[model samples]
Target: MDLAERIESLKAGLLGAIAVGITFTFTVFIHQTLTVSNNWVLPAFPSSFEDLSAWVREAVAFGSGFLFGVTYRYIIRQGENPHLKSGAVMAFGLVRGLAQIESISDRFTSQPWLAFVLLGESAIVFAVAAASIDLAIAWRWIKPAS
Candidate 1:
């Protein structure tokens, strides 16, 4: 209703949008970069080495974006709440990021630059999502205690 609340809500939407966009875009770019190269390949991990593993990886990479929307909203809330601000968004996101980076990175070593760009993009997305994550926590999109 108020100006501040309006601004927060708008920003929340933007952060969520950005998170989903970054996750999907990065995954696609990484997938293209790897698949285009017939030499470099992804190693077997949770599943057996097969085309199915690659497909699953593709799905997971894209799905990781879902977390970003929530992650960013919570990060954004931190600035609004002193309590949330005290807790570190980067540190918190670090845990989530591990899976993200690994899930996304495993299949992209074929094109070193593409992988690097993906990483750089991830950092920017993280920065954006961190702010949103603070907000999400403050706004109750995610648990404050988390």
Candidate 2:
């Protein structure tokens, strides 16, 4: 790809990353809130936004977002295919969700329900990221790679 095309890819990726990061963070906050209010008997995840581990969680979320964004931009390229877009989102979500399930299984508490919730959360986050990227592209804020 040419230098300009690479730059456009970077722009698109950055936008996607930001969208994913924000969505992930919001979901986490909601999860924490629900867990706290309901006293859900899930595995010991960070249940409070004020906890020290929240920083680590945020970092991981955004780092994952950056990776997803760059890959997703390349996957969809300049195509307007809805299948490609939805497939990309599902691919990322399933990978993340399955990993979480495996991790939960390794734990003694074995909160399978929590894992499913995480899976759904992953899908939502990716969907939001994809939609945001599409909107950005349509608005000419992010030109897909040529």
Residue-wise C-alpha lDDT for candidate 2, range 68-128, written one tens digit per residue: 7777777778577888888888888888777767656766355556766878888888888
lDDT by residue (tens digit), candidate 1, 1-146: 46655454555555555664555455555555675675443332222225575556545533444454444444544446644433433443454445545665655565445444444444555555555555565676544322
TM-score of each: 0.37, 0.84
lDDT agreement with native, every candidate = 0.49, 0.74
- What does each candidate score in C-alpha RMSD? 8.8, 2.3
Off by over 4 Å in 2: 41-45, 107-110
